[model samples]
Target: MELNLPESRSRSIRCIVKLGGAAITCKNELEKIHDENLEIVACQLRQAMMEGSVPSKVIGMDWSKRPGSSEISCDVDDLGDQDSSEFSKFVVVHGAGSFGHFQASRSGVHKGGLEKPIVKAGFVATRISVTNLNLEIVRALAREGIPTISMSPFSCGWSTSKRDVASADLSTVAKTIDSGFVPVLHGDAVLDNILGCTILSGDVIIRHLADHLKPEYVVFLTDVLGVYDRPPSEPDAVLLKEIAVGEDGSWKVVNPVLKHTNKKVETSVAAHDTTGGMETKISEAAMIAKLGIDVYIVKAATTHSQRALNGELRDNVPVDWLGTIIKYSK
Candidate 1:
């Protein structure tokens, strides 16, 4: 029953978990903030923190859609009942997925999009949305008794759209761990000075957290299972139990057109979200693992936020323990 984690590893080490909307939200990605499934996830996280298995810092992704946008209208407030048992004990960071995705696709505002000349009006609008999203999570976590802080690339004078150098911000995350407070971050469409408007996903946020803080574990609970050799829908596709993220970035390309593969991961393999594709997740993992952090890709169905926090989804395998470990790896 004792987890053979290293003695050097702090029992209170901060854990940076990236939650995908597909898994946390109800069908069609509806914002059911008070749904039973979410409560279960929160309970699992709280239990893990209470047990000292992971640090008290638990962050969630809340995509911030544009103001007056339909996606943002889904649900904004509601952490848990004020008197609920799982009121506090963690930090939550929700991305503006509803807003970012739309803006990125429609306005062509991403690190790539910003490469071209853009008007100041457009830049201001994007920044506002990004700031508002970060603030919303901060407010919610504060109300829940878990003091949290917002760390955005923009606040750092970095573009929200592209992957710029973030060593200083990473250090800030380390400080969060040292101080016993949780820091929440999300994938943002930042204003890249070089790339203009760049899009960063929640996975990228976790990657930055892992590389900087070097947490004991990084759990990404997406809509599907772990990684597969081929698409999971195919009958012959095999689930990879464990993979040492290839440094060559070979896993970066699953298909010619699709930069990342589109399959759910099993309990013991590297999982990929087809939308952003597998390449993105693989690259991020490669970077995190280099710092000696372990990343697990779990399907939201089996391991909501809470289940993952309790280590129920961690594979028992005793390898160096880096990159996408599922239950079967043991």
Candidate 2:
């Protein structure tokens, strides 16, 4: 089937943005999309793309006019032209939340492949549920005039015995992005060589794409403002504005909270989420950070919290950005 897409422009900044299931859906409920929040995020993404004032040259530097710095000489005219036509090449990945998680867990689909005859039915149920959510998300992006195409990992992705991605046919995804269509992918049940079928987490999908696509930024839009010293619900918990990876590719939290064992950190999955939630997200971000790409974990449900994803903040200035930045030290 041929997909109608916007015309492509010159090579532009590539970004991979992930919409967390908890942020976009009432994860505790069954397949309920936070319509208002979803629309808010969609609109903000459109606005960010349309606004040409965003500097695109540097990864993590102040936008100030530094002498001999590419950041200072960024061609605003080029950006304006690109925005007037279409957003830079970008991809969106959303979590399944209540859509696929509940069904998958009940059927034990995450355990690997469909070894049991009963699991065949569970696989179908899980796929159908996730597709429903994908349609809803595509519709939301459509309302914002985004030429969004839905790509199911179940159709094109495979896993090894370890349940990790063995191979995925991303050719169509690349073609779609290059053709100026935003491909929306979601975590779903996929065929596994060893286990039969297993659940692929959205975090895993983003990591895989980052390795292949080599985008300038990978943003995880979640329910919380950013990574915190501890769970935000706890007393005196402070948000960690930035996390720097060491020369050896190891990351450490600078706050003294790491010294205290009494404080509890909330990395548990949501009640309905079968995939490891915040814990998985942090680990994925760490892996991407080791590659020298900056990853931001930010809240997406509110207009105020959408700044980091909007591309207005300086690449190096996470303090001014409204999120926890995972990056390597200079």
lDDT of 1 by residue, 58-147 (tens): 433334566677765322354353232232223344444333444444455553554355533444555566566566545444443344
Q: Please state the error at residue 235 of candidate 1 in Å.
A: 5.1
Cα RMSD to the true fold for all candidates: 10.0, 11.2
Model 1 earns a TM-score of 0.62
Task: Give one digit per residue, the lDDT tens place, for model 2 in 1-330.
Answer: 112223453464467889999889987789899998898888777666655554333121113456676655434454444433556677999998779887898888888647686688888999999999998898788666676888987775545445778877767688778777889999888887778888888899898888777777788988888877666777776777777777776666653345564333464357777888776787788888777778878889655355666654544454455677888675
The 0-to-1 C-alpha lDDT of every candidate, in the order given, reads 0.49, 0.75
How many residue pairs collide in each prediction? 38, 6
Error of 1 at 224 (Å): 1.1
Lowest summed lDDT window (length 10), candidate 1? 266-275
Model 1 bad stretches (over 4 Å): 1-12, 25-37, 52-96, 111-146, 160-162, 166-168, 233-237, 246-275, 301-307, 312-330
